[model samples]
Target chain A: MTHIIFDLLHILDEAGIDQPVAGNVISERLGISRTAVWKYVNLLREVGYVIDASAKTGYTLRKRTWLLLPYEVKRYLKTKVIGQEMHHFEQVPSTNALARQMMHEVGDEVQPGTVLIAEQQTGGLGRMNRVWMSPEGGIWATIVVMPKLHVDQIFLITMAASISLARAIRHEFELSALIQWPNDVFIGDKKVAGTTLELAADEDIIKYCLVGIGVDVNVSVEKVMPNLSRLVTSLSDELGHDVDRAQLFSVFLKEFERRYQMMLKGESEPLFREWRSLSRTLHRRVRVRTIRESFEGEALDVDERGALIIHKDNGEIERVIAGDCYLI
Target chain B: MTHIIFDLLHILDEAGIDQPVAGNVISERLGISRTAVWKYVNLLREVGYVIDASAKTGYTLRKRTWLLLPYEVKRYLKTKVIGQEMHHFEQVPSTNALARQMMHEVGDEVQPGTVLIAEQQTGGLGRMNRVWMSPEGGIWATIVVMPKLHVDQIFLITMAASISLARAIRHEFELSALIQWPNDVFIGDKKVAGTTLELAADEDIIKYCLVGIGVDVNVSVEKVMPNLSRLVTSLSDELGHDVDRAQLFSVFLKEFERRYQMMLKGESEPLFREWRSLSRTLHRRVRVRTIRESFEGEALDVDERGALIIHKDNGEIERVIAGDCYLI
Candidate 1:
């Protein structure tokens, strides 16, 4: 029903601004009720779409708001559902937190490709209970993914997301972007974006996963953490101009869709290759802190499960499934 | 403060059951006021510990309710907090679902050892979204664990839990119990208990995990799934009599504490040894269904991460991190 209305609106939008087509013409072209066309226009207005209407002067597209409405997103989206049904919030504690709540409320009914977007996050959380700074003008969003992968391969989702972000940033501004191990998008040794993934699953299978992404789109370094300010950089800061958030988001969605499909198909070698190509942690001298002990080594490669294979100074290799990785 | 009260109560309990000790005697022995001793006895009563009190008779230990009250559990608990502060529900969807909700409501303020227990579950969940039969007289509990281990090693916790349950049953009932790979606890090929673990973590560090355990303690197989009537058995059915839930819970707690401590200290080798010794899945041809694909292989061994390492017929070894393992 919604799709039909959207199709009508798209047809009307393509009819050009100066040309006002009659109801008879539209009905003859699309075989829908004239009243139905009028109802859809009113519905679009109720949802913040300014469509000019009249008896003689048919519908005219006025201002296009950058609100992440489902209709607006779907117009540009090419993927299945990731980021298709967006929950836009002006202010939220955290997109991840809201996504988690929504996951429970919706349960299995959660639409695949549902995106939770927040303009600002007051209590944005990072890994290990650390606070993620999500000020205004930043892309603070979480994407729900129902990937058909084993729990071990779950890390590939995050890897794909990181690669997607890196690809999007590179494509938009032609900047030299690199990916940090796990899920941080870096630009010339400084972090520009980060992601935290939370999976809802039992011992045997992953039910769902929420990939929370925070990109420093237009935010300045002073807005982020003081300690991280030196290491983190923003797109606007890098390019000396503000990037279009809507455009970046659409690009990210498209890239994420391609990568996610590959991941779901168990075609991770290509994604892993792309990730490795963009990763700065690999071949870099790094120190990893596990719970029991800490080890310093050179990162050799990442395995299929996304475990870091580190070559120690003693000619031994360690496969680190989980640990805090620090570039020394 | 609660600890001091329980200590005094323990002393009074050990004094005599028939002859009640006078408040003056307790005050003198514990070096506190008679009024304080009276207050402590009232507190114990509030926590479901039935103490018969009289003017001249003083206080006599009659019977203690096996309720998992915070004070009662804290008094006897040896671990940090896993089951010390239990939030119990008579009927809930699932202990794990409740735990996840509580984790969000309380956020990081949730103590590590907090546990959620349900008497009867309306939507008791098992691995792969299977319906877990949690009728009355069954143990439906979720224990919160904040282990400083790698995300991969998190599986060892489940392994340890199964080992703990098997050992508890063996020690308490002198019955031969075994573990089916991944989650199920069995007795002589008949499944008796099962567990589900949910992890909330970042790529590097795991924030917390909820281990939801369901044991057919005193419930008959008839109370469970009709299909499992011939295959499944309960503790009561195995023992030919009803089992005291409180005693069984205590035994499980003690055994869990031992294994949990061992796991925390990086002593998973013994846990794996015990799991191997008590496992029914080993040396069997099994079909593993992961989300991506299905494969058949001989169950070789459970590695350190508690992943079932299967040696396929094609001479390739597959480390299944998460999947439904079915014996063929």
Candidate 2:
């Protein structure tokens, strides 16, 4: 029944938006009774799909839900492998945590490019296990991929994800989206999204990598996370209205899949160049705080491995592989 | 009751091996009745403690069991952190998997340096999820540690673990235990032990690292793994008898804790130097097979991050980060 309903939706989508098809036409096309067609359309309506129905015209699709349901996202998804398999949840402790549990339980059976998404994460995490405010109307997702990359090169996965997010946000909202050092995306000066990558490896070979991303699409950032309000902004806050999350998610997955495939083929130069071009931290004076020490330096460039190369005040060069960067 | 049994065993230990202690003496030390003392001693004997009892001369400690029970191992453990808390099981799927599960369940409550060990793993795994034949006599254990290091530098944890295993095997058996490329330990030409490090990182900072070390102590390698008979070995096969596994495990934890502490304090140079001296793969003609390509080169040296620097036949120096290395 669910398949029939999704198939009905697909047919409606192919008929083009707001185009009405007769009830007899849909029943004949689907090889089902007219009563079944009406029932499936009602089912879609219950899930927030707007279908105009009347005695004169059978049905016309008006709007689809922005709730990030698998069927809704799949309808607009344009990717080869990424997001092909998705587990959508109304709520989870953390999508990354759930993804890790799934990988551990299933081991090799968990396919690459499997996405675990939650409408709300009760305990969402940012870099270094920091608390991330994830409320309803935000995209909290983790993507599991067994990339054909070395352990040292796993940082490129985060870079690619950040680039994908920035590009998607720019494409969707027509806002100038930029990336901060490491893997945080920005709009002008306020943080909009963040990407984190977790890796499991055997020796130097990567067993699996989890790319976790959180984007405040429709969230009221200041109201949800008052402590971090000054530094963060949501898409809805910037645009003065909510955005279609399902569409943004589909675009991000397509961009991510394209860049990820390139990295797998050892063609990472173009992706790295893109990351550099969209980076807001490069060529800026920044304070790099690592676990060991903190220092201020000119952010020169990011190497191929994604390490930040900095020119220090004492005329010495420092390469920081992992740290927190703040624009000075 | 378990605590009473362990306490009684400790009292017998203090009386010295083969030195008999009167029943009244134990009851006085434990503030228990003579019947209670006898019951506790029986409990200890049931769990593999060797105790000699006589009506005339109370009880005497004969020998401690070589089983790696927490009580048995803790009696000799010298480290302050590593192995201070241990979970011992007769059989498990894999110690590493269990450690990961424990961490996921309890999060920060799962302390660093905690050890999970199993007598046998029904579904043991090696590098790249290869089948690891973990019989009753092997030491299959995983130590969970939250190290203060960058994700890229996590290879050093494996290096430290390899060095510790090699040192422990050398100290215990007087064998020429050397480490192969990455983290496999060898005695002569056959593999005697192996170490695998799995890291969970938030971006560049390591959240926790599971250092899984498997040592074939008293196992019969040929009988257990016929295909790998020529490539692997056990301590008993070389020494002509079974080794005290508790002693070996205690030594390894001590060595590991020392190196781990040094790493936490930003003192990895000495540890890296030690790894260099004990490496069997360095300065040898070897074949490095990565996911992308395979090439043969002279293994010149290892960098601070444990990447293999190879001098290729084409007069170019290539750095191999993660791969399967075979000596030519």
lDDT of each residue in A1-328, candidate 1, tens digit only: 1356667666766785445656556656667655445545544554456666555555676755444445555666677667766666656788887778655533444678778778788999876667888887789999988875678788899898999999999998899888878778989978899888899887758888998888999877765566777878899888887766777887898999899999888788899899999998999999999878798999989998888999987889999887778889
User: Global CA lDDT of candidate 2, please?
Assistant: 0.85
Using TM-score as the measure, which candidate wins? Answer: 2
Report every candidate's CA lDDT: 0.77, 0.85
What candidate 1 gets wrong by more than 4 Å, as runs, is A1-328, B1-60, B70-76, B223-227, B292-296, B313-316
Kindly give the number of clashing pairs for every candidate: 5, 1
Residues B54-115 of candidate 1 have per-residue lDDT tens digits of 55656787766455444444455566545765665556678898677556534454667667
**lDDT, model 2, position B124:** 82
Which CAPRI category fits model 1? incorrect
**What TM-score, over all chains together, does every model reach?**
0.43, 0.49
Give the chain B TM-score for each candidate.
0.79, 0.93
Candidate 2: tens digits of C-alpha lDDT, residues B1-328: 1356778888988898999998778879999766456545644554567787765688899978666787877877999999987777667788888777556534455557889888888898888788888899889999999986799889879988999999999998899999998889999889999988888999899999999989999988878888888999999999989988988999999999999888889888998889989989999999999989999989999987788999997889998888989899
